[model samples]
Target: MWSGEESSRLYALRRFVDVYPTITKPDRHVRFNEKMWTTTFVLIIYFAMTNVMLFGLSGQALDLFSGFRSIMAGASGTIMHLGIGPIVTGSIIMQLFAGAKI
Candidate 1:
């Protein structure tokens, strides 16, 4: 059992998190064409990024996590190589720490 009060140690962080900028939810319904266009644009950008290799990376550079590439949805030696992994990892770590009250 715990009270809802913020811990003194985390009071500053809580305030900072609250004031952080974030994308606001749309107020009105989005049109189908708008949604399709947005999806198509994003897909095109993603494909383009996947094809663009990292600058100065050797052609023979070995990928240690080649087996997990499909699962991670990332390209080897590209800018998006660690896409979503760090974000998801941080989220999970925060969740675990919060659950343990650490």
Candidate 2:
């Protein structure tokens, strides 16, 4: 349980975090070229990132999410280790909040 001051501070922190530009479904339709270019760029970045191995990771270290590799789109012990996890999670949270009218 949080004290009153702690709760207020937490609320403020939440507010601060929420006050950022989020990737929302656009009000206006995107042009085909724009969509294509955006997608291509993102894919290029993702693929490039996948090839980047993390430094100082020992080969003998175990991957905790090896089973979920296909679903997560990340390479074990690489820069893409968290692959799409953060993006997917944030999307789900936002969708849930929107559904709940929060």
Candidate 3:
């Protein structure tokens, strides 16, 4: 039998990924988008240097990016990792409808 906390956690996770396909584009890039810019080499070096700094700065940035790694799989995984929670997703639906004045 599942504990109360476990059941709620499962339900909460399910709700966060519950979004419709909006009329707008969901994302513009994938991971390792080195081709998106003309300055690929420069961006590579910049990313590398940032990694060096992040590795030396107690690694909080790395931890954050590790959370974002799920986004590489696309939006469902992204929402799951974010744990944006149930009420927030419901609120966003209301927000979009309000914006549309519907």
User: Cα RMSD for candidate 2?
Assistant: 15.7
- lDDT of model number 2: 0.81
Task: Provide the overall lDDT of each model, using Cα atoms, as 2-decimal numbers.
Answer: 0.81, 0.81, 0.53
Model 1, residue 19: distance off in Å is 14
Clashes found in each candidate (C-alpha, N, C closer than 3 A)? 0, 0, 0
TM-score of each: 0.52, 0.49, 0.19
Please identify model 1 stretches exceeding 4 Å from their true place: 1-25, 84-102
Pairs with steric clashes in candidate 2:
none
Model 3, 1-102: lDDT tens per residue?
Answer: 867776665666765566734476547764455556647776675445333332234423335555454554322223333444666988999999999999
Report the lDDT tens digits of candidate 2 across residue range 51-78: 7777898757887888776786767877
Off by over 4 Å in 2: 1-29, 83-102
Clashing pairs in 1: none
Tens-place lDDT digits, model 1, residues 13-63:
776887789999899999999999999999988887777887899858988
**What TM-score does candidate 3 reach?**
0.19
